[model samples]
Target chain A: MAKNGNDKSRHIIQFIWTLITNAYLIGFIRGKIYQGKIKNICVPGLNCYSCPGAAASCPIGALQAVIGSYEYKFSFYIAGFFIIIGTLMGRFVCGYLCPFGLFQDILNKIPLKIKINTFRFDRALRYLKYIVLIVFVVIMPLLITDIIGQGFPWFCKIICPAGTLEGGLPLVILNDSLKSAVGLLYGWKCFILILLIVFSVIIYRPFCKYVCPLGAIYSLFNPISVFKYQIDKDKCVECKKCASVCKMGCNPTVNPNSLECIRCGKCKSVCPKDAIECVSFNKRKTN
Target chain B: MKNNKSRIITVSMLLIGVLFLSAGILRGENIIIFEKAINICLECIGIG
Candidate 1:
């Protein structure tokens, strides 16, 4: 009961944060900032840096900036920050903090008439994120150098609907000059955004499930991440109820820390025997 | 019984931790290194 209450409270808080970070609010705040050093808060999860309303710096953008900086070295500060957050909370950030994740959650609530069962295909395609993490997020930027031999934001340009919807749209709208300069790349991004918006209405979080390199990176820590779920085999009867309720279709009993498991706690809430519990690495070590 | 449970949990955590650490290290080495960061920065700033 207490766990469920905590989950509900966390969900509410996440929803409120999403509202505050929406394009309207961020744009308003950014409009107020004329000059001085604006302290940009780095929230975990993908938010767009180019969004006219964004008050905080997108971590991905900052990381890319560091990568693409004139200096020929990676910024330890940004990398360390992401590592610390990922190791500590894993995808809990995705479930409890990401504004984009919250947007998907809201879209998921729209009383949709059509639903597709792509569990098998989805399971296979989940590996695609690791490829994306390597190719788009990590490799492409590093390997592709220009005349002066500097990296580019390949992932941001090619993919990332958050960048398109939150960053690209607002900037183009607010600055009429940018509208006139719109090209094939802008159209491509808009197309991707539309596809994602429509897909989100049908699927839970197609991006999070298949495309989010950030999610892929965080998922690497899912097993050993401080915030984790455990299943007591002694109490479990192999009822498969947990699996049935899992939106990610992950079997908690087989692998409680499956990369696909978002640590949403839905399975834990539904378990009859209270076999599942959210455990901390520190707590386990001390015991 | 308690010892057995503890051992299982410890072993599980160790294996998982090693897997994650290895992957992180591999990714850091193979993909995200200093040279790459420099390249990305240059491209974004349009000097590339």
Candidate 2:
């Protein structure tokens, strides 16, 4: 199938945004991280704070840090960032802004063994991200504290393939000291990252579909986000073209605002009758 | 009526976000983010 122009544009935007957000070139060269005022601001996607070129904090990482900190139990800044961004675009951030999403997109483009459009237990597995959000991102950071009452970023330490791929590998590769310090945890994370990379080649966005806590958080706002999918029932012919084209397994005609829908516009692009449109919540009635 | 309700909800959420953000800034939470982000996160890099 020919690539849609809009899809092409989205890929460009994703690439450009990834570069813009991770624009600290000096850090990559010197094997050091960017320590600047911009670091105080959290990025909208899953870019790692430990990424040498990253100039902004990751929302998940910052959230975990604040929740884990003995001195501070909650962070209004992080909460507010999530609310504002989620309400504005929901998983649109996953579609267009996330660096790891871009990575998966690129990896999926590689011609590999037969692609599995949907795997066994796909329906049930989608709920795993929510579990990860509650347990790893929220509970672990809040409940499990050290002797000094400091909590650890359990998700980052334990399950975040983005952290492993973006922060762990690059820093370890660049720093000899880090290479020597690598242990079982690093190996475990690397194994998880490799598994995800392999799965992403076959199943599109396996992490976002089943593992990303951030995606789970943003998805809660999909039904109410200002920007959302709207189908023209009048123009629709009940063709399942949109569903077939949807990598996220959403039926745009039936439930355009499914939490699984990333607002990636693949469904819109492939709709033959021009029935699909991404409309704001306020303008929904007019359409 | 539904549209009005949605608009109200959206506006309310935005206001709440603004309020939370203002409170966070007032409490110097951004400084904490800055401090944490400035350092090398050993756990994040799998070195912790």
Predicted model with the maximum lDDT? 2
Cα error of candidate 1 at position A126, Å: 0.6
> Chain A alone, TM-score for each of the models?
0.88, 0.97
- Residue by residue across A1-287, what tens digits does model 1's lDDT show? 75567467767978777665543464544332111123233557786645555445566666665565445335454555566677678888788878788777777767879965365687889889899878877677677877776677788777878877766665566655566777777777788888988888888888899998888878876866777888777788899888887777788999998888787788888888988888876333222
Q: Which candidate's DockQ is highest?
A: 2
Report RMSD for candidate 2.
Answer: 1.4
| lDDT score for residue A96 of model 1 | 80
Q: For candidate 2 chain A, which ten residues in a row score worst on lDDT?
A: A278-287
The docking category that best describes candidate 2 is high
**In model 1, which regions exceed 4 Å deviation?**
A1-10, A19-26, A29-41, A282-287, B1-48
DockQ of each model vs. true complex:
0.08, 0.82
Model 2: number of backbone collisions:
0
Residues A94-212 of candidate 2: C-alpha lDDT, one tens digit per residue = 99999999999999999987898887899999999999999999899999999999999999999998888888998999999999999999999999999999999999999999999
